[model samples]
Target: MEIRDLTPAERRVWRAFPRGRRVDFTDRPPGPERTVRAKVLRALLLTQGAADGEVASLRMTAARITGRLDLKYATVEHPVSLHGCHFDEVPFLYGARVRQFNLQGSHLPGLDAATIHVDGVLRVTGCRVTGLARLGGARISGALFCDGAEFGSPGVATALELNHVSVGRDLYGVGLAAHGTVRLNGAEVTGKVNLRDAVLDAPGGTALNAKLLTVGSNVSLDELQAQGEVRLHGARIPGQLGLTGARLSEPGGTALDVGAVVIGSGADLTGLQAEGRIELHDATVTGPLDLSRARLTAPGGVVLDATSLTVGSNVVLHRLQAEGRVELRGATISGQLNCAGARFTNPGETALRASSCTIGELWLREDSLIEGAVNLRRSQIDMVHAEPGAWPDVVKLDGFVYTALNPRRPARERLPLLERDDDGYVPFAYEQLAASYRRIGDEAGVRAVQLARQRRHRGTLPWYARIWGYLQEVTVGYGFKPLRAAAWLVALLAAGTAAFGLHHPPPLKPDETPGFNALFYTLDLLLPIIDFGQEKAFKPQGGYQWLSYALILAGWVLATTIITGITRALSRQ
Candidate 1:
C-alpha cells in the first residue's frame, strides 16, 4: 500500500466545513470545525469527480455531524468512510442503499441501519454504541466486521439486533461486548459467525438469541462468557459449532438452549462450564458430539437435556461431571455413547435417562457413577461394555435389549444386574440375559439364565404357588429338563419297589392283601389311572398303608409336573 497523505486543498475542505444550526451540538466559536449536514455532504460527494482519488485518507475525529443524519429511504452511489467521528443524535440509515460503509472508532448514541443494503464490507471496528443498534433485515453484499465494538445500554432489553439480515460473507464480532440481548434471529450468513472472546450479559433473559440463524461455516463462541441464556434453536450450522471454553451461567434457568439445531460437523463443547440447563433436544450432528471433561451443574433440574438427539458418530461424554440429570431419552447415536469416567449426581431423579435410544455401542465402564435410575427401556444397542460394580442399583431394564453385554466380570457378579429388585424378574429380562449369553455362544448358559429367571419369578409368588413352582423345577426343570424328569420317575419307581419288598406287612383283614408282585403292585400305587386292583384289594395293617399313601402322592406330583412342563414347551413354540 502506498502512502496517500491528506493534501493542503483537502485540508481546506475540512477546515471550512460548516456547523449546522442544530440543538444537540454547538461548536467552540466556529473557528475551524468539520461539521456538515447530510444534504450538503451528499452534494459535495456528488461533485468529487476526480478529486475523490486524493481523499482516500478522508479521516476525521472528534467532529460532531449535526442534524438527524437521515439517510433512510435514499440511494447514494459513492462509498462513505467516517473514522473517529461523533454523531450528535442517532443516525438513521434504515432502508437506504450505499456502495460501502466504513465507520470505525466512532461514538454514537444509536444506529438504525435496518433494511439498508450495502454493496461492500461494513466495518464498524472499535466503535461504542450506547443504545439499540438495529440492523435488522439489512442486506450486505460483503462481510460485516465489528472486531472490538461495545454495544448496549444498561437496563435495555436488546442492544444489537440483526434479525433476518443476510450477509454475503463472514460476520465477525470477535471481541464484542453486549450488556443486553444480541438478537441474530433468522439471520443468514454465508460464512462464519465468529464471536470468539465475547462477553455478553443479559441477566433478565437471553443474552444471545440466534433462533433460526443459518451459518455456512463454524459459529465460534469459544471462550464466550454470558450471564444469561444463549438460544440457537433451529439454526443450521454446516460446520463446527464451537463452544470450547464458554462459561454460560443462568442460575435456575436455561444457560444454553440449542434445541432442534442441525450441525453438519459436530458440537464441540469440550470444556463448557454451564450453571443451568443446556438443552440440545432433537438436534442432529453428523460428527462426534464432544463433551469430554465438561462441567455442567444444575442441582435438581436437568444439567444437559439432549433428549431425542441424533448423532451420526460418537457422543463422547467421558470424564463429564454433571450435577443434575443428563437425559438422552429416545436419542439415536450411530456410534458409541461413551461415559467412561463420568459422574452424575442426581438421585431419585433419573441422572441419565436413555430410554428407547438406539446406540451402536455403549461404554459405562471404569467406575462411571450415575446416582439415579438409568432407564434404558426398549433401547437397542450393539453392546454394553461395563465393569462389575458399574451398574446403578435401580436400573430400568424393562424391554431394554442389547446384542451383547460384555460385562468383564464373573457370572455371579454379572447376574445380579439382571435380577435385581425395583423392577426385577420379568420374562424380557430373562430373554435379554439369554440373548447376551447366546451372543457369546453359550447355549448352556442361556438355559441357565432362563431357569434362574423362572426361579426368581417363582420366589415372587405366594407359598402355595411357590411350592408348585419348586415341584415343577426340581422334577422336570419346567419343560427344559426332560432327562431329569425321566431320572426322577426311575428313582421313584425303584424306591417304591424297595420299600414294598423290604416291609412285607400283612393285611388288616385276614388274607385280604394282594400277592406281592412288587413291580406290578408298585405300578398300581404310583400310576395315576392304573387298574391293577391293588388299592382296592390291599388293606395293609402296618407301615404298608402309609407307604401306599406316600406313593400315590408322589405319583400325582410327578404326573402333573410332567404335563405342565409339556404344555409350557408347546405353548412357547
Candidate 2:
C-alpha cells in the first residue's frame, strides 16, 4: 500500500481517500491511467489512516477496477462512493460491515453483499449489472435506492435477490429495468417499497417475487411492465399497494398473484392491462380495491380469480373489461361492489361466478355487458342497483338474496331476471323478488311475481298435477287474482238462471213444493251446500235434468278449486 508502488490511477485514488475527495478520470482515455487494482482499493479501505479527524471516504469516478474486491467479515469505517466505475469482477462483501455503500451510475459484473450490514444508505442508482445483484440477508440501516438501475443479463435466472433482507427505510427502484426475476421474499422494509415505472422481463417466469414480504409503508409499482408473473403472495403491506397503469402479461398463466396478501390501506390497480389471470384469492384489503378501467384478458379462462377475497371498503370495478370469467365465489365485500359499465365476456361459460359472496351494495349499470352466464347463487347482497337491461341472458339466482333494488321496477320487468336463471323453477328466486317488491310497498308487483311463480312451477309438475295447476291459474291466477274467481262465479250464476227460466221443471210432490222461482232454483242447483225446497221437490226431465246435473258438478269443482287456492296462498304468507 506504499505510495511509490501505486499505479497512476491507484495513487490518485489513495491520495483522495483520506480527505474523502473524488478522483475524476473520466476525461482520460481507457488505459492504465484510468485503471486501478481492486486489491489496492481494498488495502486502502482496511488500512489505518493518520488521525486527521476528517471524514474520509473512497470516492472515485470513471475508474476500471480489476480483480474481486473481497471484504468478507471485514469492518470498513469509511464510506464508499464509486460513480461511473467499471468492475471486471463481482465484489465479494459477504458479512462485511460498512458505513455507507454507493456505486451510482457504475457498470459492474455483479455484486455479492449477502448478509452485509450498512450503517447508512446503500445505493446502486443508475448502475448496470450484468450478473446477479445478490443482497440476500443484508441489513441496511438507511434506505436502499436502485432508481434507474439495470440488473442481470437476458438469460439469467435471477437478477436481484433481497430475500430476508431488512431495510430501515424505503427501498426505491423507480424506473428499474431487470432482465430476470427480482426477488424480495421474506424481506422486511420499514418504509415504502417503490418500483414505479420498472420494466421486468422474465418470460415464462416470475418477474418479481415478493412472497411473505412485509412493508411498513405503501408499496408502489405504478406503470410497471412485467413480462412474467408479479407475485406478492402472502405479503403484508400496512399501507396502500398501488399498481396503477401496470401492464402485466404471462399469457395463459398468472400475470399478477396477490393471493392471501394483506394490505392495510388499499390497492389501486386503476388501469392495469393484464393478458393472464390475476389471482387474488383469500386476499384482504383493508380499504377500497380499485380496478376501474382495467382490462384483463385471458380468453376462455379465468381472467380474475378472487375467490374468498375480503375487502373492507368498496370494490370499484367500474368500466373494467374482462375477456374471461371473473370468479368471486366466497368473496366478502363490506362496502359497495360497483361494476357499473363493466364488460365480462366468456362465451358459453360462466362470465362471472360470484356464488356465496356477501356484498354491501351491488351496482350493475345498464351499460354493462355480460356475454356468458352469471352465477350468483347463495350470495347475500344488501342492495342491488341494477337496471333491467343490465342482466345477462343466463343467471343462477337460487339462494341469492338482496334487500333492495334501484329504479323500483314492477315485478313484470324484474320477473324476467328470475326467469333467466338457468336452474328452472327456482321458487326461492321468485320468492326473493316478491319479498323485495313487498318491502317497497308494491302490492301489485308482489301479486305479479307470485302469479309468475305459479306458472313456472306448473311447468315442472306431472301431467295430472299440471292440469290442476293450469285450471287454478286460468280460473283465479293461483289465488293471486281473486277478482277472476268472482267474475267466473257471477258468469256461471247468470248462465244457470237464464237456462232454468227458459224451461220449467215439474214438481214431484205438489203438496210440499214451493213456488218455482228461476233465480232461487238456479241458486239451489249451483250452491250444493244450500237447501232450497224448490230443488228438493222439482223433477227436471231430458236436457233440463242434464243441465241441473252439470250445474251441481261445476259448483263442486269451483268450490274445491277456490278452497285449495286460498289455502295455498295463506300458507305462503
Candidate 3:
C-alpha cells in the first residue's frame, strides 16, 4: 500500500500524530497523506495469522499509537511500537515481530502460546506481565524478557530460554536449556521451582548455574529427573529445597552440588534417588535438614558429604539408607543426628565416618550397625544409644546413657578382670559383689562392703604394720595423767626398800671377823626416811617399760583430733 501522493486532509493528520497507538477516528479516507498514514498504522498493529500477508517496511522517522494497538491474529511486516501505551488486557503477539522490537513501557495481561515462535530478539524491558507467562509449547530463538517484570501468577516456560535475559518471578520448567547463562539474579518467586522432568544444559561446567539467585520461598524439583547436572551452588533460598522425587544422575563429578549455599529455613532431599554425589559443604541451615527417605547411590566413595556445616537444629537422616560411603567430618549439630531407621551398608572399610563432629545426641536404633569402623574420637555427644549394639565398636556409645540397655557383650567380653595378685582397683567388682551378695541375701553386707571398698586403698600396707605412727605422738615424761599409774609403782618400790632395811636388815654380827655390818649400812643410807634391808629394793630394776605404752596412747589420740579439725575447715573453703 505505497502512497504515490496524498490528499490535503490526509497530510494534516499525518503531520500531527501523537506518541501512542492511533485509534480510528473515522472510516472515510482523510485524503492522500492521511490515508497513507492510516494504512501504515494498520500494517504495524495487525497480529500474525496463517493468511500469508506481508507489507512494505515503513520508513517513518518515529511511529506512535494514540490509542491501544490491537495486533491479534495479524502479522506485522515492519518494526512497530506501542511504547508508553496502556493495554487493558493481553494483546496477543504470537509469531509477530519486526527486525528490532521494543515495548519498554507497557502492561500485558497474559501471554498464550501454542507452538508459537519468535525469531528476532523481543525486548519488553520494563513490561509488567500480569498473568502467567505460558510458553509451555512455544519455541523462542532469541532472548526473552520479563525481567524486572512482575507476574501475578505462576509462570511455566519449559524448554525455553532467554539466554542473556533475566526472570523476575518463579520460572517453572520441565526441561529447560540456555546456551548462554539465564540470569535471574534478583528474581523473587513466591512458589516452588518445579524443575522435575527438566534438563538444564549449560556445557561450560553446569547445565544450569543459578549462582547468587534468590528464591522467595520453596524450590521443589521432586522427580524433576535431570539428564545433565543442576548446579545451584550459591543460590539463596528462604525456604525448603524440595527434591524428594528428583533423580540427579549426571556423571560430571557431582550432579547436584549446592555446596557453600545457604537455605534460610532448611531443605529436604528425601527420596531423592540420585546416582551422582551430593555435596553440601559449608552450607548453613537455619532449620532441620531432612534427608529421610532418600536413596543416594553414588559411584564414588563418598555419597553425601556435608562437612563443616552448621545446622540450626536436627539433621533428620532417618531412613536415609545409603549404599555408598558418607563423610560428615567437622559438622556441628545443635540438635540430634538421628540416623535411626537408616542403614549405611557400605560393605568396604568404614561405612559412615562422622568423627570430630559435635552433636546434641546420636540415635542408631532399630537394628542398625556400622558394619565397619565407627570413629567418634573427641566428639562431644550428649546422649546416645536408644538400643544395644549388635556388634563391637560398630556402634559408638560416646554420650551419656539415659536408659541402660542390655550390657554390650562385645565391650564387656573384651575387658580384663582383676586377678588375685593384682594390686590395682578391680574392674567390674561392683557388679560382681552385688551378684554375690544377692545370691546370699546379704543386702546389708553388700552395701556396707561396697562403701568400704570404694574408700579403701588397694596398693598400700595394712595399718597394723605402722603402729609406731600412733605411738610416737604421745607425751612420755612423768606427771602426765595418762602415765600416773607408773608414778605410783615407783613410789611403792622406794617404801618397800626402807621397810626391808628396818625389819630384816643384814645381821650386824654377820661374818664377825671378815664381813661388815649390813644392818648398820642400811640404817646409814635410809636414816632420814626409813630403815632398809640389804636388798636391791630401793634401786628398783628396769621396770619403766609400762610407762612408755601410756605415753604412746596419749600422744596418738591428740594427733588424731588435730588432723580431723584441720580437714573439716579445709573442706568448707
| lDDT by candidate, in order shown | 0.81, 0.93, 0.50
Cα lDDT of model 3 overall?
0.50
Residue lDDT tens for model 1, 407-428: 6444556678876535766678
User: What TM-score does structure 3 among the candidates reach?
Assistant: 0.46
- Looking at model 2, residue 356 earns an lDDT score of 99
| Candidate 3: tens digits of C-alpha lDDT, residues 116-163 | 444544555455555543443333344444334433322223222222
Q: By TM-score, how accurate is candidate 2?
A: 0.97
Give the candidate number with the greatest lDDT: 2
Give the candidates in order of lDDT, highest first. Answer: 2, 1, 3
Give each model a TM-score: 0.86, 0.97, 0.46
Which 10 residues in a row give candidate 1 its minimum summed lDDT? 17-26
Question: What residue runs in model 1 are displaced by over 4 Å at the alpha carbon?
Answer: 1-43, 52-58, 61-68, 408-411, 474-494, 505-541, 559-573
Error of 2 at 43 (Å): 0.9
Q: Rank the candidates by TM-score, best first.
A: 2, 1, 3
Clashes of each: 0, 0, 31
lDDT score, candidate 1: 0.81
